[model samples]
Target: MTLLSWSVIEYSAKYDAAGELGHVRDTIKWGADYLLKTFNSTADTIDALVAQVGSAATAPGSTQPDDQYCWMRPEEIDYPRPVIECQSCPDLAAEMAAALAAASIVFKDNRAYSRELLHGATTVWNFASDRAGNSSYLHRVIDSNLARQAGAFSAGKDHGVFSWDNKLPGAQLLMSRLWLFLSPGYPYEDMLRTFQSQTSIIMCSYLPVFKSFNRTKGGLIQLNHGMPQPLQYVANAAFLASVYSDYLEAADTPGWNCGPDFYSVEVLRSFAMTQIKYILGKNPLKMSYVVGYGQNYPKHVHHRGASIPKKGGDRGCTGGWHWRDSKEPNPNVIAGAMVAGPDRHDGFKDVRKNRNYTEATLAGNAGLVAALVALSGDEHGLDKNTMFSAVPSMFPSPPPPPAPWKP
Candidate 1:
């Protein structure tokens, strides 16, 4: 949700041009309202928040199938789905604060609703701060460990990926941007600067000139070897890299330095563009990772909602499972859905059961939307290099999936 909010905040002009600004805001508000509802707050303090909405199973040791094991639609979820609450969860609280804060900025025109969002952000931020106790937040920990030396900022490294499971890299960049709005010595000023410098390091790491990231033979960044899911990380890396380029342009800094080497903003933006183009069907398989984008995109997306038909009768949990193993293409098309993408060797399987390559995630699509918007309708000074030749006139059979990548 935080990523989704940032997507709008980063590309408001594009959304406005598309006549979808209000729709985007309403979408964000829906997520923000749910976030606010997760908090158990009174006045200025939060007692606890719902950390999780669904459990792994029905009971502690029961073998009964429940939410996690079931594949039924949302309306058919009648199982014992419990909400897990937590008190000292700084990560969750802080992410919620960030989301609400960004959404507040989006709704700033509506003073009343904006104030409500700002109040929620403030309350959640305070909760995160109070629960962290000075030892948990990234900046404070870096300060404690490095004694606020220049090396303290430079020591941090970014894997060039961000998602629901990790918010540290995203938080650092956001806080770094927030630092520009603060007065010197305004309590967390130094902390923000530390984050700012670390953001620089993060951006530096993604630049191809730095040679920090490993790219596949077909030019896709090989970070996680495409295990579990790959496109989400690629999409996130592209989004953040593009955002940092925009940050440089906004700050009028011209470029960034990765140690001895200096990379222009154009280079950074071009790297982001290369990533976007790769997903849109420029890879080894000449396959678009996003569904419903090009003719050669995935037809067997590993999603129940996409694979199953929307008939009158309710297809209970067991019925849904039958659809999961079907060999046919999905009955429904999830347009603009970014799937898990190819392996490190640029190999992809369009099998319905292959979650690693066919599954689409909200996080992946959020990043994709942000990147697409950031680079939309503009192609000034982009790298036009291709990793492989055009698809053969006479198509050949695809090679088997490569062995698991080793460092």
Candidate 2:
């Protein structure tokens, strides 16, 4: 699920780097189309989305002929696929809202698809917000399902496979950004109110001032989770930074200045860029957590399908367990996947089972896409409708300088 949302946001920017616009559109559209299938614009229920695949009461692939310890292929799995839907969860609704809204921009040239995305985004947001008070009921439904099923079902109280407590603000901001774009700067009453409400929550409650979300000398966002601290808030910070960059553009201050505003654009960009560089190989670990990118990286990604085809020392019964430094390199390469990352001291322990350091999924990379695209000077018409279109028209270039003097 995280992979679905994160894929759209990051793949678009990845295409920007590679100049493969068609591939980027194709990659993002795949996830966006599936997400649309999960949602119903007229209804305010989870029926629009499939809460679980495979065994509803048990884990995926649990029905295979092989035992629990054996590898079971997806085609061989047979189980009752029960779909669950409810209205109490706001987090998934909000994520879908953000995902579809962002994709709306990606498909802006396609009027019907873009409008459909907006409708879906608005529907999910209203659905979630209407039942915000009843969100606590989620635990009951999930726990009851877990009781009924004798398999490894991902039954829990949370609204997602992973919690989205810190991610809500970013989701809201992205949705708000899409709202503004679709409005074409003509803000409607409901849309404007939603934007204001979301922006206030972020600026007044979750920014550098918030104590529960921020507790560090360096201002790293921290949560009470057992995993590393920065993972909780860094991505959202990057998203917020992109949103802030948009804010700065609208303000149109001379030379992209900062500090005059309550939350400076420069501060936001600095935090976003630092976190991005850290993931791209700029820490004490000195390893790029992004697979197949730069410097040293974790070879043994904690992904089942990506590693299933390996051979030799890299492919035994326990071959996937080769996370230690002495282990053979993982034969399969999962490119552009951002793994679970480093500790506060910039230390990384790479292993397939190390969810703290080696787990990589689509959810973690969504913000990576935002950071990269914003850092790319809005090359893909994100902030602008067309690339290099109006800049030269608005401000004529000064004459070139004389040939530089050779040393």
Candidate 3:
């Protein structure tokens, strides 16, 4: 079912790009068929999910309700309303609007969804305004939903609030995508403000404390602590630099990991690199790094001297053998090197020896490389295909004025 939905969206996107009426018709047909299939197979499951969510929302001592289930409520109510002709029908007009906007891509005949998408964007704008007006720490309120949910949990110990922090990013990402398609008249100033404000907090609080060491050269230097390497900082820098290339100079800073784990590093680097490339017109392929080989040693090595675990025997006697061997380059550093050079050479080796790669050695520095490539229009030794999907589309035509809603 998920795959079907994804394919429908994907094909619809292609059809939209082609702008062929017949293709659009075919795309809509496919989407409607998939929707019918989903409705038939998952009707009971959907009903159950909606009921559960509604009950939770209405129950005594109910706290913050989950938005996922809340979204489903509108879906369930809207899906059935279009099929029924009763005077006292469910009021799922909002949900219907969202669904129609989503489906309109596939069914070009329904341009009405474009207006719905704009309305939804306005709704978000309004919510953001309301929160900003009321909250003292507007930045914190906008940056994370965790604090809000935590407060709810404290207030209502018996009835837990469903946390929204994890889901907020995805929601924002989607809304931003839809807004791109709808091109609403309202400025994206609020969204940009929130992003920049959060970025500033991250830079001020974390970037200064990152510690850098030439793992190959064997020396520890405190650069900054808690610096979210290639992910948050690098990505943020890349975005800023793209917007105002002068900031690229600031990209040269050592990065530090908040948590010492492969997954954490991977997530940070991948997300940062991807965003940098997308925003700065850089080659994503060049940003790609190898993982699981301990190839990039300097980035992973702890500046503090390494220690071996003690080995003990059953007889309360210490064993001569060390539990784990201490190596100059941590063998477990299995991660890919950031893409570098117009030739797309593995930049890891240059940085690994710690000879010249300084703050410039930061993985996000690749964004600078991208910026250079883009500015120079250098096609040589660059992979265009890596960023083919990341390029933004032309602004969609302004939606027709919304029709008056009938009761």
Candidate 4:
């Protein structure tokens, strides 16, 4: 059962990524077949169990004498008998129930999938509603539908799931682009408020440690000694913040520096770039000040101890590298930039180059650095190049001159 469930999820992702209408159709068909098969097999077992339960009732000295017991009814029996019972009849019923639920979900998902395949944005939005009446397992489907419908109303354009309000800041940028394509007259203020709400939760609550650390460098965000320390929470929190720009505002808070070492920083940056085109409009070139204390240096002290040169079998910076060794970048940088406009070419260029560098020489580090650069621009100070260089439109230009001496 687990394998089957995973298969459907995996295939769905693959089909969505394929971006080909025909491929999506075929993938949905295959998924439907699997679901139907599982359902039928479960149903057959249920039928056989009902027959056995009836036979048992008829046997001599059985506790169940006549049809007097309400539980005697086949439908009333525990669908998937409890472990204590271990009776085949109950087990069969349980399996059947699960299979039916899965089938129902697959049906709705297929409808949305089909509508997307046809490039019918309106159809997809209409199908996204919870009209199917299966709330327990279909809440995600409903949410997804609501988001997509909202996006359709905003943007005149249509794409598969890509044209939906994802409740995440980074995701919103992508949806906004589609909305623009469709030319829908959406309420920008309402959208911004929604993003702000999600960001506040992620920054203040989810990653309080990171927030604390952002306020005080020596605080919890830096402590890695104890279990469930602020570092892990910060990692996760930063990840959430990066995807949602509301958290990006948190970056403006003092003491926190965006860089590759911060795990969440990089993750968030990647999400933002994929959805948005550029970071906030402040061009990196406009800022003459560059602080080197946090740039390009490792953020976490623990990482310094973990570092080993390539020849010594050390991981050798294989993971993502940040702008500052210690400070983590905000994730929404990418998405923000993408949505803002193409003028931020320098920032995008920096991301592409840095991403390539990390990809070839230090694969893991590249992702981290790329995400950070995308988020905070060059301000975190990993390299001396102007933050302006990281914008998407700044391509074809040579790397910016090294930073001038600090002092």
Best by lDDT: 1
What do the candidate models score in CA lDDT, each in turn?
0.72, 0.53, 0.29, 0.29
lDDT, model 2: 0.53
Tell me the tens digit of each residue's lDDT in model 1 across 1-407.
67777777667767777787788788788988998888853347877888998776646665465755667666666667778899889878888887887787777678888788878877887888774232344445335354344233433333445667766677677665555432234455766677777777877777666667778888887555445577787788787878777766766568877777778888878888898899999988999988888899999998877887877117676667777778888888988899988887888889988888898887788888877777775522221111011112223468999999999
TM-scores, one per candidate:
0.81, 0.61, 0.23, 0.22
Q: How many angstroms is residue 77 displaced in model 4 relative to the true structure, after the best TM-score fit?
A: 21
Ranking by TM-score, best first?
A: 1, 2, 3, 4
Winner on TM-score (2 vs 4) = 2
Candidate 2 per-residue lDDT, tens place, 1-407, comes to 33233433433554556586676577678877787776576554544455444332237655332323333223333433456665466667767776777677667679898888767777776665554333343232224343234121222322111234444344445444444333323223354445444453444333454343433333334433234634534654565655555554454421222224455555556656776777787766678878999859888776655544533233333332332223455557888888877665456777765567777756567556545656665422243333212112223468999998999
* Global lDDT of model 1: 0.72
Instruction: Name the candidate, 1 or 2, with the larger lDDT value.
Output: 1
Q: Estimate the lDDT of model 3.
A: 0.29
Give candidate 3 regions above 4 Å deviation.
1-110, 113-147, 150-196, 203-407
At residue 21, what lDDT does model 3 achieve? 31
State how far residue 225 of model 1 sits from its true place (Å): 5.0
* Regions of model 2 farther than 4 Å from truth: 1-20, 39-49, 55-94, 115-167, 171-226, 229-232, 254-264, 310-326, 378-407
Tens-digit lDDT track for model 4 on 332-404? 1211111111111222222221321111112122122223332443323221112112123312568889989
